[model samples]
Target: MTNSKDLAREIVEGTGTEVEKGRGPSQASQITALARERYELFMSEDGRPYGVKVDGANIALPLRGKAGLRSQLARIYTDAHDGSVPAQSALTDAMVVLEGVAQAADPRQPHVRVARGDGVLVVDLGDADGQCIVIGPDGWRREQRSPVLFRRSGAMKPLPLPLRDGDGLAKLRALLNTDEDGFRLLVAWLVAAFIPDLPHPVLTFRGEQGTGKSYSAKMVIGLVDPSGAPKRTAPRDIKSWATQAFNSWALCLDNVSIIPDWLSDALCRAVTGDGIVDRALYTDDDVVVLEFRRVLAMTTIDAGALAGDLAERLLTIELHTIPDRARREEAELDAAYSDAHAGILASLFDLLADVLRVLPDVQLTERPRMADFARVLAAVDKVKGWDTLESYKATARDAVADVLDGEPFAQAVVALVDRAGPGGIVLTASELLERVPAPDRLPKKWPKDPTRAGGQLKRLAPALRTIGIDVDDSKRGPKPKKQRLYHLTASADRRCETASPASPYDPETDSDQQEEGGRYRGDASGPPATRGDAGNARGDAALFVASPQDTGPDQHGYSRGDAGDAGDAEMHPLSVPAPRTHRTPGQDAEDAPQDARPTTPCARCSRAQWNAEGSPLCLDCRTAA
Candidate 1:
């Protein structure tokens, strides 16, 4: 008689088919039964096979193909049977075949882990009971686990909670300041954090030292992670951003002096939920993971020149030092903070529920930055009977207005529009140059030459579009050259009609009629060429004898005297282009010497140097030198 162990050995050795002297046909049946009993294929509930494993510990290792399966089984054979080398080899091959047959018979076993991201709301409801709660823009419910990847990883320590009350609300309101637009923006940002996959705007806090930028950041961080601490240093670069994006739930860089270009690009990607591929730590293959679209905020004394696209994606919250500001530092506030946070959390849940309940019926005429958030606020109005949505819009509008006001070209546009008055005015390129005040007349950096001003106007079209201003080319009313018309309409109106090319700017026509006067002007010559370009010709023929101030680029990527941060290098339209090198009588194209260093004149002294070190200033002219 062939016992079960003997039959199993025979089957593993591939000798089950060969009948022994004492074994009958029944022994083959035993071998088949034992093979079926020894291995089973485990699968996930979602239908992913966890792969084949032995019956004992049932470990799922990455064993696929004949070579891999044989290798895996040879180890198992040695462990199970204490077999000799040749016997182990035969058993590995035999078990590989047997496991294949068994897997073919019954291929699936079940295992499951639940994870999901709602476009505007994500809550990690882990596989455990009584741990998390689920809320949405439409409704709310409590669950055992949280869906937030940052929260799930235990990166944050949530504060202990007590029953809610209205007492803490008043104090909290005073602390955050309900009247300030910055406070309102913070609330909107908090609401956005609960939203799942949408690109959330980066919240940048710019203020002088001791103005509570870091404190404000701590409050925001507490809302997201409850008891989390903000990382008080800037990330080194994009690679660091990539690594940190995966680790931190919400990144809050404090006192950032200069935002590197690469970090800005990475932040854009992180906001958009784009994936970044990096080489795995130990593996040769590249690991492509979803770029964590984590909530981002930063505190800076002076935010460096942000790329234009990045600027569009940022919500700047300017903090100021007040003489008699309310007293309560983070440490002093921590005593009441935990209970206050608990109340806020409870209120927040209630707010989310109300928003979701009325969301479908709420109507919004305009979508602004954080538009979806506005809709949520609209829902809050419908259900909570609060004027939250109106406040939200007002806050966002003012923030944008402030950004535009900071920009030199944008300010020039505003000045022109203000001059146009209630009915609006259309000015010809030449007329516009005559009417729009020069930098000396109004603010700074206004193009003095008509053609240079026209070029500035063209570059500023996108900025104008942001503020609901319209611009178009027209060849209206007996004009040989096309006139670029500025259509400044009531900001409440989003769309603007194109100006009539046939209707030229008439100091006589009503501003309302200007739109109807212009016929479509297609493919006409742009503003006439002027000496130098918009950059150098900014002082073409100064309207006044204004002395130019020499202020170097400060930490904010602007001259020290500027009201705010300068536009990014890529977005800075007025930066002078490199001077053209014209051949002299004795000069040839080949005569130009090639050198590793820049041939342009030094920024400081404006003198050309043959051996200038890589600095923007010549060696002697450099500040450090």
Candidate 2:
């Protein structure tokens, strides 16, 4: 008799010849056909990974772990044949053939029990009946089965059956320990979570100890994705964090006390559309990708000063501690929430569908860091006749900061420039350090030496400019300009220190307290060519921005001025300035003429004082001369 190997090889190599030969169907064909009959295999939504659709189910089984698809197939064979399982050799041969089936399949974008389908929002109920809800311009209603393939994780729990008339939203809202503006933001975040393809903002809540931060987070997560584990402690590292991301649609870190550098970077990536990559196993070259644009939320008492990138992406909402008279037992709150859960979900769906109907007509003059999030919610605000976006912008604009509260280097730079007056100071890293040494209680991120100081300045230049401090690296000129120098001045609104164009802000005497931002937008009204890259650089400078490494010592870092050592600060800023023609760092009078760039005006020529109407002369110090 022929061995199973001979039959398997024949099956794989066969053409129409097998049928023409009119022989009995081979054992290999029978084994492979069982999988074909029981499952439908195809690529995932992004067209990079594969998943299996179990014959009569709404959920798609992932082709992830070593036995992800194989185990199910083994169970199927046993159940089909009177508790007699297939031989291990036969099962192995079948899986190899099934792999071929998967390779030849088409790509289908799988939804995580929530997706947009046929001009409506599709949310799988995750129930045993395979039911789902279709929400759109017409309204929301239940369907026998979801039209989209819902990718369910092992940890995913079913959503509450939505009640069209329930006051669930009001109940949930009353439970939140926030003000009206905060409530509006909370609702907006919930709506944005359901929308597809947009970059979602991180909905962060912080307050005193008894503010119900974790409880609020749990309630919010329940609205979209109700899981047995609603709130998780922040993961220790990026790898563990990525694992948490794969297991749920909504990721909530409860009462996080610290936002470490690695976690901060990862959260930013997740907020936007960046992927989380990890080793498939400890001993292999294989990888896993959780690249989906997911909904992110966090609760923190004080993560301390947030990183600039994180600040831009954060929709920070403050919660107040529950008054002793108002506080209720956890069991009471849970029982009431359970009663109202379905209605709240229904009301949210109703609002989202209405917003979707008018979403195309909504226009935002200013788009923030999470522009997509703004666009969708702006549409909601337009329909509701509310200024929810205005509230979001106000919060975001205030939070988009370069310097964390109490940062030594930035505070020192502010002081140094304040002392020198408007012209600012032109000096090297060491000189600047010598004159304006960091305070005794140096922050952890402060630079220890000149090398670190220069690096810190390079990173802080864009952020510093937000508060009206300009830093520039001057090019070597004639003999007088022997040392490469860094030119510091009160921001251009205050002086004619560097050769970049007039900044995009009020061209007048600014207030003493320079605000971090006036708007949460780039120049959306400006032409794309003129605006350049939509980077994190605050204000007009971001319109034409690049990465800090792209800027290097040549543009704004510590150059080897007068043969000094390199000094850089520890933490890089959230944004770097765009490349521009700066006054060749401390270029003397003649050097500017040779480069075809205008020379720096005399010390008296700055924004601090008015110049003579028709006179080329500017300095009040020189007016007497």
Candidate 3:
């Protein structure tokens, strides 16, 4: 009787000679019939199946035969044999055999299997042997892994600490520098990490040097995935973002000094599970094949580094560096971790359990910023009797206000509105340039030209929208140079519970104080009338008309008859005064028009001002004109 090895070798080496000689079945049939038996014998003998297995997922793909492994052995033998031709040939033959065997393996029959399905979070039920729960945010749950799962992936393996209540949790919270809002935000972030499909806001820790920004980030990240290390270099460009964030669970842009607009936009998408695409490296194909999502955190000395859209997707946490300039020793921190790591993890699991328990009847009355996170926190609050994450909502409101306030353009717009009073102001870009005072704090990149200024304001439209300001480009006239009208009003006081009672009526004052589309509607007609006598009006207060064509009371009902013209009107003035005109030396009097016609004695030599028509010019000036 032949042993199993001899039979297996005979089956592997057969060439159908026996069948052709009418002494046995066809080689293909013989191989197919004996393959399963050989696989069983092989596994029983070696105690290891010829297949691949991944940690999180439960499926295993089997090999048809061991030829691929033999090819690897052949290569090793060649290394030992000084690259001999025989060894190289053996490698080639082994590769061919492996390919044949893989093709011949039963495609429908899997050789190995695990107890659970592929997911981000896998929980052992523990009530009985092999009982488990697999959870994902995609609304899919299964007891078994899909037929195929990625063999190698950057997916994280979560390490959950055991559940218990103690001062250690409170101590860890203190160590992490998490207040009520910060703690809620941290919990939301953890939930988002487990539920990969949820949209999450990026947590930005900001403070001066010695702040525990990095420490807080690492400790929070370590609770879920201790192996995921924080990267100090933030992705400055789009390419870097795509390349660096692909396989990461949580990307920490530690000690970031500057955040470029591109990186900010990328982080916004990444925080919310949006895929960022990039071209595969070393490929001629122009296709963008790489896409992924990951949690993002950043430690910055300047909280104001990011602006506009990026600022909207952030939860800004200002960490006060430990007082007394005392830094906790690394060992002490580690020991703290060792003592409380399990309880903290248990708290997270407890949070998740609470969420799952109350998910059926959860009603969100208000969708706050980072609404998904807000909802989760609400669920936690419902179960735990917490304040329902009100602090976080307030923090979000303040973050938005800070971003608006920190931005010079936003500040300028706000200043213009404030100066306009409770009633908002509507002004074209040109008008804004002529009337609105420049913000005291200006950014280095502030646009100098009116054209560029208009573009910059338009770029800020989205950010302005978040603060209840509406920028309207629809007012564009037929001309390309016509400036868009930006309508800025007193941003609705989000913090106010009830609108302030209507102010006392003053019949003499402008009654159009009511906000229309968030703007104080002044007269709809045009620019205000010239102030302080046409000749005397100059600077921003003067009504500088184009071609002197609009030298009249503004359509908003302001007229020369009114003792206090609209120009003198407070914040809700009808219009901004035009610019003062300067005459060129030796310019003809005929060239100057209307209010702009110079009143100075030297006057234009050619044209005549209304009052200066009879006045005589010096002979030399006349001749030059």
Candidate 4:
């Protein structure tokens, strides 16, 4: 009577291989050896043992879990027996297989969510077959096995083969149920996710009940990474969160009402790539290290004033309640979406192709937090004539505005500046703290002292600047303590400005410095500014005099104020294309609108400046004073 193990060994090692009765390997040992021959073992980048096996297809599995070595052994036993094996023996066989492979494993590179191959991108489908979608510049194709090893989480669901048709993304849009702006932002998020190398923005769905926020978010998750359970509850700990992230490529947290500070922070880290280590279940020095980045989306009723850091990384799309008449059954809606998903996926990949093609040419004047995302999306928008990036920026600006209105410190700063008037006020941290006491929302959250108050103001400055209240705490006052100086300035019209203020020093008053239209040329009193030289031999300052063709500079929309922050600064249109026809220096003055003459003092030297260069200052003003 052949026992299950003996039969399993025969089936795996091949039926009827003769061996000396006394010298033949035992059944379990023989099965383990045969299993080792059938599967490949390798170490993870972090030094954990993993196995890859082929049973008509290749798949990578973890060595530590039942899903890996243990599962494989069970399958082999079942194949040989043509029926179930005793549970105890099956478990023992799995342990033996694990020991066999783990000892001889070799090291290899590992990928989390996605991988880049030669001129191609391999996106994990998270399907049971361990298949991946391989995309190239020409188009995309599905593959049974990946060119690179991917550590897949069992929770990841499979994505359908993308369809190619004339329909475009029509089906997808109907299901999303958002306005044009929301749709564009959503598309941007989708496009950003496929490119794993860049940091992805967090996508959030917001609305009251019956709005179908969860359904919409679920559809997105389905397209990117389909899962049996599309949404998950908030993880209890960092390790738990990592586990959730590792198991799924697209993380959807449903019904999130509030994001605590720690979770908010963790989300930020996860989107940009985060790593963790936990002590192994029973070992002292052994630890499990997981490093991952995920495409994170969530559905919420009201997340409530997001943390500033978190808000910066969010693409918050507000959804509207579905009218009772317009609302469809979840089953019906999901069915339609599932049917159209393939086509929608194809459309997104098409957009991604265009993005990658035009990425090298994307020349953004400024970069935000996820700049790579911004650049590629901007490239696609420019090429496809889509306003996605613009819509995103507009949404960001609105969020910033809301943040300013919501935060007491931010509101106080605006009030303080409004009281100071257009002339603005210069105050120390202690003085500023005295002027704006902490608001009542969170007493502990408010800055404790002048130093903390100063830091808080700095943090809120970027948001405040959007409302034309610029905060400059970079410069500090002299001395025993070197207390920081808070430079609060505002536009009388409550409009933000990016151009540096023109100098207050009047070159017109000095005959040697003044040229036509009072524009400064090289100092006539000093030796001629050596060709490119700015100032005299002593390095006093370079003052340029216009060549007196006598006309005002072009009317450039000018706002002369502090634009020290990167994103708040406005770029002038007249500065580009180098003026179609070259003009005599003073012809600029002739073309200028009389009102376009700049009145603000140069941020550096306080000298009144010409706006020809858009900001103030005739030249670099580091030494102009």
Which candidate, 1 or 4, has the higher lDDT? 4
Residue range 1-625, candidate 4, lDDT tens digits: 6677776776565334434343454446545655677777777766677777755334567767667666766677667767655364545664545655566666776675577888777887666777778877677788888887776666766677777865647777788778878887788788778877778888888888988888888888887878878888888877788878877778798888767778888998988988888898778998888777889998876544666666667777889878889989878986888678888988888877777777778898988667888887788787678887877776666667765655677777776665442435566888777777566665545777888888888787766665567887787766887877788887644522322123212322322222211123322222233211222111221222223354344422322111111211223121111111334457566465432343333333333344345643433453443
Alpha-carbon error at 435 in model 4, in Å? Answer: 1.3
Q: Write the per-residue lDDT of candidate 3 for residues 462-498, one digit (tens) a residue.
A: 7666666666666553376664655555454521212
> Which segments of candidate 2 are over 4 A away from where they belong?
1-31, 45-51, 66-68, 85-93, 279-286, 398-403, 415-435, 449-455, 458-625
Per-residue error (Å), model 1, residue 604: 36
TM-score of each: 0.51, 0.71, 0.59, 0.72
Tens digit of per-residue lDDT, candidate 2, span 1-625? 5566765666664321344466754434555676677678776644334445554656676554445566676676678667876666666666666666776887777777678887888888888677899988878899987877777777678998888765656877888889988898888889888876677888888889988888888888888788888898878887778767766778788887667779888888877666776666564886656666678888887634666667767787899878899999999989878888888888898888888888888878876657878888798788778778888877775555422443667777776665444446566777667767666787788788887888878876755665567788764323864655677777555433222222222324422211122211122223333433222223433343344444445545531111011221222333332333335677754444422333222332222332333343344545676
Q: Which stretches of candidate 1 lie over 4 Å from their true place?
A: 1-130, 136-142, 145-154, 159-168, 178-185, 204-208, 226-228, 256-258, 282-285, 300-308, 314-326, 409-462, 473-625
Q: Give candidate 2's TM-score.
A: 0.71
Measured with C-alpha atoms, the lDDT of residue 224 in candidate 2 is 79
At residue 50, give the lDDT of candidate 3.
Answer: 35
Candidate 4 deviant stretches above 4 angstroms: 1-28, 54-58, 78-106, 422-425, 440-444, 465-470, 490-625
Worst 10 residues of 3 by lDDT: 495-504
To one decimal, what is the Cα RMSD in angstroms of model 4 from the true structure? 14.0
Best by TM-score: 4
